[model samples]
Target: MWARRRAARQERLDRVAAEAIAEFEARVSSMLATADESHQALLELRELLARELADINGLLAPGGGMPVEMVRAQLEPGDDALAQMDRISAEFTAVRVQVIGKGAADRETLVPLLEDLGGFVEGMGELADNVFGAAEATTELRVNLQDARKDLAPLRARLQPALRAAEDELAATRGAPGWHVRQVALATLGDRLAALEEGRVWPTPEKTTVDLYQELEHELATLRDEIAQTPS
Candidate 1:
């Protein structure tokens, strides 16, 4: 009978130990999951910062007019981003404290802390969106600038010859009827060419350099025809 009682007591102790071990493992698992979430949030923040830096670098590349200091100043993260980072860091530290201090014996403290961690993760996600949103805008601006340059290429090619022709016409028709008109037209064309070369006239989606060049080409052609018909 004593032997049987001892076996029953041994079984109860084993079951209690098993339950305690399971509970401890569960707490550890929760802690690890919280840590992993915090780590992911940090990684996302880092990626966003890197992207912003890359955009600033592009603005400071060759032929770029945006000042490096201005771009760096604009790209600096705002207070919200910094605050989110600090909060996440604090939460991670809290999690570590819970792990070391409680050692699975204290479950209540970690539950609320985990909940706070979740909120922090959500905040971090929102902050990342705000950070990346600015980068996206800069990217769009760069694309528009590139397209403007593309539109200007052919226009520049056609304008060079037109400018030479205008100069030649002015010299050939000196002191003739409507010579002053031709000279004035040539001056106007020269101004436009200079503006384009100096980047004063930027082609937009609404008003492309292609359209402007076509209009100028037509005007120059009409001027040439008029000059040809006039008697010498």
Candidate 2:
């Protein structure tokens, strides 16, 4: 009967899908893990740089919302990284369901998909990926983190180097307002720069990288004279 034939066909498909689904589910798990790691790194970078920027802005007082609030308005890279990762998750889920939907009976043609997915999840162990392959899941997230690094470069090039010159004029001043040189500043600035110097910024201990945030609550405490504040 027609029902019997249909039942047999469905059973064949279920059998064929078992092993392929297991292999692909394993790959999907790896992809999700990579996405997660990238997402967290991007979030940390945004917070670190934006906090520094806020301190600089507070010191300069260009006449706007509170520096902490203004910091939020200017920063969008963290959100961008989140959005991109969400999209990748959606697409990966769709791919997971469809990848061997018809079963992997045709192994040769399926190799490309498997390879591309591997490259994305694990970075291909190469300096350069294939010319026409899917970018690793974290590529944009890495870019966002890099852009955050760039955000702080102006501090070194324009702010810190020039800060020392104005100290003499400010030396006799009282309190922080009369002295732009006594700006509230991040003590972790040097440490952050060193971590980013090698073009990567992970595995850094919280204390070693940005433990001064609590100290920031007492902004006046960090408002040292320029002579003491200048980067060596």
Candidate 3:
């Protein structure tokens, strides 16, 4: 009877852990997809800007002649494209800082907590296996298992809410208008900048997008390892 009860409890623990892992993976997948889309969008915008610049240079160099002052005049700061680009760029930077800095930092706090949970589950599974396979399940093993379950209960209770909160935050970040708005602004800015700075090479914004994407991907991978390390 005691063995049967212990087995039932162990099943429950396993079920809870499995559910938590599934929820976590789903959330991470959604977040990663959003990040990937954002990175791609930024890359496309950067390329579009480069092409616009090239086009401007081609137009300006009619018969291989240059009109630098005219190009500068065309690229005045007050131009609609530049103004819009500046605004969107500022917004994009602000959003990126929030997402990459605060958002990532907040998620980082969860990684260690998850690792702790995973470790607890593994410890419990080993204890269960040892005790159940023995000639007689010992009182000490039962006590230890009970204590482990007690410790794990609160973590399991906390996991769902914490995961939900993270999911909400990620969704908000993904749905922010600034990301889309910035794309349009970048396209316009690229056209204006190209015309103004014809034949001058400028750095691409894709580097920042790639960096942020990689950072987020690394974090996700670490979290995945933690989840996988947990005993089923």
Candidate 4:
């Protein structure tokens, strides 16, 4: 009887200890879950940052001048960057898994890992914000400038031909258009002609929009002459 009584007491003690351990693990799991949330947030932010940086790099490359929104839309599609953020968040969920796998007795071993994960999360968030913000700013500026250039195109085209024609007529007439006529014509043509001469004009394929076609042809002939003179 005494032996049976001692066995029962020992079993009760073991059960109590097991319950204590389980409760401790439950608390740890909750804390780990919160940390995982933060880690996931940081990973998402980093992914978004990387994606934006890539987009801006592509935009800033040679022969690439599309608007920011358009480029962004093309990259992200319907769900946009948010979808990518979600994907990154999911990818970092393994941190939570790792922490949750720790036993009650493993708290000492697990705490440092959880802390490191948190630190990594904070660092990633900072890095992502910095890179994304800079690239976004640069891309926005470029897009705005491109939009302004687009707005100026029609005026540039209309004014260009008239200015070139006036300059040509004045040149052909050997400045004989008289002092007042010459002054008025040159003044009227100066702004647009100067802009053209400075190469601020937009691209217009063929000779259709340009008054300097014949002049360009002459220049091309001169270039051919120079090439011909060079030793083969």
Q: In TM-score terms, which candidate is top?
A: 1
Q: TM-score: which is higher, 2 or 4? A: 4
Which should have the higher lDDT, number 3 or number 4? 4
lDDT per residue for candidate 1 within 1-232, as digits (tens), equals 9999999999999999789868866867775676677567666666655555565456454333222344355455533454556666676667656655664545676567656556665665675566567546555644554565566567667778877876886688788988887788778877876654543555555756556666777777787777767677
Model 2 per-residue lDDT tens digits across residues 11-42:
99897787676775676566546645644444
Scored by lDDT, the top model is 1
What TM-score would each prediction reach against the true structure?
A: 0.50, 0.28, 0.32, 0.43
Model 3 over residues 1-232: C-alpha lDDT tens digits?
9999999999999999777767766654555455445444443443444444444444444322123344435434223333343444454444434443433225575455434334433433443333233312222323432453444344434433544443443344444444344334334433433332342322234532223223333444443344334333
Off by over 4 Å in 4: 1-5, 47-105, 121-146, 152-232
Please list the C-alpha lDDT of all candidates, in the order they appear.
Answer: 0.63, 0.42, 0.42, 0.53
Ranked by TM-score, top first = 1, 4, 3, 2
Alpha carbon lDDT of residue 25, candidate 4? 74
> What lDDT does candidate 1 reach at residue 50?
57
Off by over 4 Å in 3: 62-66, 72-232
CA lDDT, candidate 1, residue 111: 62
Better of 2 and 3 by lDDT: 2
Clashing residue pairs in candidate 3 (N, C-alpha, C atoms within 3 angstroms): none
Mark the regions of model 2 whose C-alpha exceeds 4 Å error after superposition. 1-13, 62-232
